[model samples]
Target: MASALDNPLLFLLVLLFPLSAMAQTNGTISLGSSLSTSDNSSWVSPSGYFAFGFKPVADKNLFLLAIWFDKVPEKTIVWSAHRGNLVLYGSKVELTSSGQLVLSNNQGQEIWTAQVTTGSATSAAVLDTGNLVLLNSNSGITWQSFDHSTDTILPSQILDMGTTLSSRETETNYSSGKFELRFQTDGNLVLYTTNLLTNYLYNAYWSSGTAGTNSQMIFNQSGYIYLRQTNGSVHNLTLGNIVSTRDCYHRATLDFDGVFRQYIYPRNWAGESWSIVWSVPSDICTAIAESIGSGACGFNSYCILDYTQRPRCYCPPNYSYLDSSNTFKGCKPDFVPQSCEPGGSGEEPRPQFQMTELPNTNWPMSDSEGYNSKNEDECRGRCLGDCLCALAIFTGVNCYTKKLPLSNGTIGTGTTKALIKVPQGNSTSQFPFQREMCFSFLEQEGI
Candidate 1:
């Protein structure tokens, strides 16, 4: 596992050391007309909006090639060309006799460098759009920092979502934390545990929006990025709202705890910074950390809010407890699995779920697929008929099934609802009364 970036000092040290040599060119690199370096030492951008300079804030130790709001070294840094590596103090960016940009520390050790991935002897420039470009002396942008990003997602920067499963920690210190926002093939954003994945095949659609800056904004008017601000500019920074509201708290942020938050912005000043309008815990697959990790409900069960208990996990209406305990890991089907694997039968049976929410869910790591159906009834038929189908959840008019059961633990949040299909037992005419009696018994025993 990659280490998390929670220690800001460590983050700065690791990221700055190698970056001191940024903008030092060896082969044949040069700067463009629109840009300039901090001390006018050398490197420049194409539009004069950015500069290759040294910053003392992250660490007083070394200089780095950072893309800031502009010439102001203190401005919000949108990107860092090299954040991890040690550059000796007093290192200056010098064009190597080879034309490559090299940073030689006080002792002459090479720190961070920008090498041409393709073309050679190219001129490097920073564009007004905040892009650092490396172009052939002939003037073609060969490589740029805009193509890659550290943790901060800037405007106009294209993000390839859903490609990586884990997410970087928030900006407190710059270390890796929890929380991950991924892209679905269908262009939706899904949140899951950095580690645990789901078993379902259909992709989870948390929110939908355009791919770039037109939709996602890092800073807004209200001073918060994740939550939508009532006083700030009105635009979807990350994902579009599935529902609308005035009193609603809607924030979209990759939070410090390593969890993405689409929460309610606190409207009351005397109150909390903003009570949780909506939030997915950092851990989304296993029942480890408090309710923060994923799959808190355990396998084959769904976690839900218990109005009376505040944040306890509950089995869905149709589901039963796998264990005698009330903990999420205890949930199981009222009915047992017919067979473990798929039979040679014509087609497999389909399972179905009713209306409910699935909170803090990640993609199940198992090899599974989803089946599209017209409605819940259709989904039920599919899972029931299939021998291989174990558990299923219906969302956005589609049914998702798994060979392995899904994590069942859940925490509170209006977001935790989804219908699932489970096997039903053959009950007699008095089944309803019997079920009610059993439920009463369990409730009294606090099962």
Candidate 2:
């Protein structure tokens, strides 16, 4: 038994062995197959359109064990094994010979495992439909990624009763977000905002209203999403299926803003990105307003529909987001909060806050007081004098005062104006008093 180190050429050959294996991977992977992020290798699908392996998370210096559209410029992830956990360099995913799919960290500790109970896997394959399947001895699928889905559902995918899809924390962060789409066991399909810390589902923002009839969520090959009832009747969730499945790739995702949208990308369209074909509950900022929980964006942040038709969250004057990178985390006051206690002589302290105007904006919910006859100035004055008032809404004819954690905030079509009370410091922080100017500034800088 001669050692490989005994010959220099043999040692070099050993170093290059893994790279050679990477190039030879095809549609079907062997039982003992493995890949790693350090080598940047993957088990590519037959058409080379999809891959199952570890991918580098941009700018974060981490890797994700997931499946994605391999040829796309964005390399959009369709499914991830562990959303809350990310791995460092040298991490690898392997289909163990013992019939288990395991993701291991650089230190060789298990991070995630695909659950299987019926039988051991004989082989695994990345199917053309973007599904990663583990086959049994008879080549029957024992486990598949389509069954335990995350946020996006590809064409030909089906969501049976009780299946849920969770949005990511942000566009870039892979952690579970505040929104979710659940097909309840009662046959109702609904979209909801979830308590991230507790996983408690709040009010339903949208629903199919087919409860007790038994329904299944299906994304057909032609790029249409519909709910099929037990009686064989189908109700389309998305209106049209104009995009041909043969010419384009499709996916329906529960976006982090709590909107469910269908998108398509032409197969031959050069240098293009995913285009939204349809969305449900179009006005997401107003759709989720309820007596409990933060609305579409987060507490203390207003939600607006940007040019892209997606929700855009912004922090008001004298308030900054709890996290700058992830606006959905909400905001915090930059200065010390007003003192609610009176002065030493029992006289109320001088007002330390003033109102800054934002036109066409309103915190639709969370009203502390409402005055039918108050004008804009009176609304502003009322909020400024009250230590409990965080904001005031004056809609030309009436006024409403709001407290902390403003919810259901939106850029409305009505004449509603938001008077946000902030510390009477930082003179440059105020937008121009003119309604037009204030709206323009809010739109331009999201102040």
Candidate 3:
């Protein structure tokens, strides 16, 4: 664990500003040269606009060996190596005399190595285009950062077919997230939400639909982003007035919220955060509709597009988030579930539950049952009587009941009003049984 090239975290970079940028120690690194977290040094591009070295991740104690835009005075990492395993204080990234670039722990055990499949590297450079490269004796690139993308692609970079860019786990976490932007071998550029911890793909949330051979996703020097085919055809990905690279810095990133955005940072900025000029599928909360898995937000939570067009999760009334630190973790009801068992009289237990009204809210998945209902009160009664019913959608005509742990919840004016059933007082402490015991009983195993 170790840190930055003097970067002060920017609130907009999704980084908290507790740690400041590191002291600048810029230059071309020759073979056998090394940069260590202990010294807080970095190899800066000739224009001094970008740097290659360690930057603070979780804190000053833990660092990510990566590259970032230098002049912004904030470490907005565009590319990184070994994100799953972070380096510590005194750790170093070395260009061995044998020409291999290796990252070693404080104990000198190699932890990460650059895949330098080309000729032996003679030197290394941090390029103004925001690419870090290992150079051959003749200055040819043996390996480059732009070729091995993390999440963001800078102007002049190409996302070659079959290459993928995975979003960070969260705004503050650098590990890979659930969203991915892949330039498929079929020549299609698709945005997907991956099943966490596995490479298994769920469904395409967005795509260019330009399936062919040898298609490349390019963020050109002129500030145009598009998919270029080998046959000289093109599909524009970004739409806006072209901002010259001479006046602004450009980065197309797959944000943690599952949106792919093109950001512009002015060269002569005056305390302004990066601006988003364009984004695909502008409203992810509505765009990420799928039959399987939770919607844009996790289970039991509704999703909406904030003013900035980012997906934000919210818990329904009488429920709370499962994890405060991560809204993507979804929500849980604060009250105990009503018991589904039959009362001693052999009748359904209806008196213990009541309904709460949620207008224009819907859970598209987990429909337990559906039927015609004449009025709101009847729809409410239908859900309250069925212990398995957690929510009932009343569309002014028919009623659709949903079960627990609801998936694909959406809150919008176009959706129907939903009546959620909950225990009358909602205080499990009043019951004779312990909460854990009640939970087991509510799960429908045995008393």
TM-score of each: 0.39, 0.89, 0.86
lDDT of 1 by residue, 1-447 (tens): 445387788777777543323433332234412112334343445434455554444456644555564433334445554553334346555544444655555676666566667756445555645566667667776666755555444334454433323333334233333344565454445554443244332233234344332322343323233322234543443344433322323334454333445444322223324334344443332323332233434455544333222233445444556654434343555655556454466866633323222433332432255777657666656665656655455554566665545543343333212434443443223111235456656875899
Candidate 1 versus the native: TM-score?
0.39
lDDT of 3 by residue, 1-447 (tens): 324434445433535321212212344677767788987777888788998888877768788888888888565788888864687788988889888889999889998888898778887888889998888989899999888888899999988788998999888787898899989999988899988866778899898878874568888998899888888888887775778989988899998888999988888886547888899887888777777778788888888665456677877767878888999878898877877766687675545778876778788777889988768888888888788888899998889999987887777786489788766766322222134345645654543
RMSD of each: 16.3, 4.7, 11.0
Candidate 2 RMSD computed on C-alpha atoms after optimal superposition onto the true structure: 4.7
- lDDT, each prediction: 0.45, 0.81, 0.80
- The best candidate by TM-score is 2
Q: Between prediction 1 and prediction 3, which has the larger lDDT?
A: 3
Estimate the lDDT of model 3: 0.80
Question: Which candidate number would show the highest lDDT if scored against the true structure?
Answer: 2
Which rank order by TM-score, best down to worst? 2, 3, 1
- The CA lDDT at 366 in model 3 is 73
**Candidate 2, residues 233-272: lDDT per residue as tens digits?**
8978888546887888888888777788888888876664
Q: Which candidate order results from sorting by lDDT in descending order? A: 2, 3, 1
Off by over 4 Å in 1: 1-48, 62-64, 71-74, 84-88, 94-99, 103-106, 160-172, 184-188, 192-447
